[model samples]
Target: MPGPDDVSIRNLTQSPVPYKVLAFYKFADLDDCETLRPELAQFCCGRKIRGTFILAPEGINGTVAGTPDAIDALLDYLYGGAFGTRLAGAEAKVSWSETMPFLRMKVRIKPEIVTLRAPEANPARQVGTYVEPEDWNALIGAGDVTLIDTRNDYEAAIGTFEGAIDPQTKNFTEFKDYVATHLDPAKQKKVAMFCTGGIRCEKASSYLLAQGFEEVFHLKGGILKYLEVTPEAESRFNGECFVFDERVAVTHGLAQGEARLCRACRNPMPSTRACGAIG
Candidate 1:
């Protein structure tokens, strides 16, 4: 969970957890992505913030972890217009961790922040309606809705919403192919999609809308937001949500799950057994 909104109470020394990890993304035009890249890297480096950032012409997407004070400074630097243009409407899913999730920091500019490799999937132009976490169940429960998990196959293997369709694609680029071959807008008119942190779903929803889907809805802030707000008793998530970091996965309430990545195969397993043993 995020630190107190009041900056004065955000002192790192007083917090129970020393590190605050933030998964954030925003879709906006960034004409100066290249120039802002090195500058952003330097700022994060100076603040000791460590995470991978994808800066692109479309927008910014990344996860960073640091002390509360440092994180506050980083957010202030980002939204405070130090980069001339504010990352307007950029919000993050925050959670406390005792350890840093990444080994080092990186800021690289790419063609698209969350690439579906389809120009039509531009969130800057349009995207599906945002469904709040609390209202997600009702939306998906509707008989006319088709919920698709837009995360990669590996991610879906560990956990996903019950009854949601898994496209089983190895990578994001394959999503376009899956849609073209397996899905039809005229048949599944009302579709909903979700991803780890809402970025992929945003792009996917945009693509679906462009493909003539009658209605598209995406989980606002994605699974992380849903887990944060939904209690375990009411949760539709069956297993741990796989994350792209040392944490591997997180459960309801965003707590670190018991599952760990196997040392050999790097697959998530509930036990500490070797890959073969688990397999």
Candidate 2:
């Protein structure tokens, strides 16, 4: 069997593909997220879409899957602002599967979309420079660069860049403590961080910049985009990338991997950390 890293685009296409899985986020001021929530949920339900969405004053974040036409319709509704607030700059990372990844649809209004808890860490204000997938390897490979993984502890256990530092945070709210205690601005100047998708790192990069970090960079479109675009031969990511869905994980080709959810944590664990080992 070819290893996970050996995945090629050949295996990426699903037979009779019927669902389009979209992962997207945007940091903007949405004064009416409360008003928009119900209508958005109703629209998704009407379109037979399934997944979760977090709408906040800061912006929106979610990963939902539906048929191609349905997905496009949802995008149109969002960008067109049928709910009265347009997400014109929303960027989506798309993939296809044979079935809907989520069992139901949910749209909730929250205080912060991704929840870093620091009011100053506003992605709408500033963020790190974007390092394209093609150029990521060179940037992180440089000795002066400090590569960091902004995801929680379990996500990093499944996969990460070769030299990245895991903050070991069990939840995103703990990230502020990790940054204040573990990082040094004067010593680690050129920082590059990433997450499962772009949301966490989008806010994280903004936080680091607010803390006086000299230079910060983030993976554009996050890991999914990297796996989708970077050929395996040129890819630096190792193991399967955990995803928030029934598929559990995906590999270098953006093809689903052999991961399953741990009932205790309700999070995807690698096959090596199967049910017997999960706690």
Candidate 3:
């Protein structure tokens, strides 16, 4: 992480496009983003636009949406420096929508972007083995592996692998706590976990391995990447996929279209919307 004294405008100001921005970067100098947050708030507040950013020693992850012109200007300012350079390959998925996407812009400092309870798990560490959709299908069909849903209870309620075991976490950070206590004694069984993007599995899988589970695996690029590459109809993934964008939940079996996001959490609600028999 960058030293607190090193914070400056030249590092944390990189921006790429307008309307909305989504990015995830590995460990970086924290002072850079902290220094920029207030400046960003002021820059965005005056324009009546909101941008949300979360920064930490482990890196920064966030999405900010606003007017086209304002967004472009912000990106220009951000990308112009070294601190923001880490966002170079950051994923910025887009969609067409008419709703007011965000309520306001917020920038805060945290310990991690996708929180995992184990502070010892470093973002700089190498990741767990990733399984492409094709390989994933073959493995699941083999019937010797266990599929774990790394997302919260609600996300799994919407959709998941045919027989995936939901960790039922309130958030990703709680996942480590769940695994430490509940893993079955049959440790030889192959284990798999997945999330919207591949990042969460990176942390969760490693933490599971640390707990002595062997043959750990996770869906490479998570379900989002799977949808982009594999045909949804041919794949085992069922129901709607929750997205970070305004389109909300997308049907995995179909090409990209408007998502059916939950009004309460912005995650995609399943076609049945039958979470724990909420009815």
Provide the global lDDT of candidate 2 against the true structure: 0.83
Can you tell me which runs of candidate 2 are displaced by over 4 Å? 1-15, 83-85, 273-279
Worst 10 residues of 2 by lDDT: 1-10
Name the runs in model 1 displaced over 4 angstroms.
Answer: 1-15, 272-279
- What's the true lDDT of residue 118 in model 1? 92
TM-score of every model versus the real structure: 0.91, 0.91, 0.72
Compare the candidates by lDDT and give the number of the best one. Answer: 2
Whichever of 2 and 3 has more lDDT, that candidate is: 2
- Between candidates 1 and 2, the one scoring higher on lDDT is 2
| Model 1 C-alpha lDDT per residue in residues 123-216, reported as the tens digit of each score | 8788899999999989888898888999888788778998899999989999999999988987997899988989998899899989998699
Sort by TM-score, top down from the best: 1, 2, 3
lDDT of 3: 0.63
150-230, model 2: which lDDT tens digit per residue?
998888888899999998999999999998998889988799999887888889999999999969999988999999999
The Cα local distance difference test for each model comes to 0.83, 0.83, 0.63
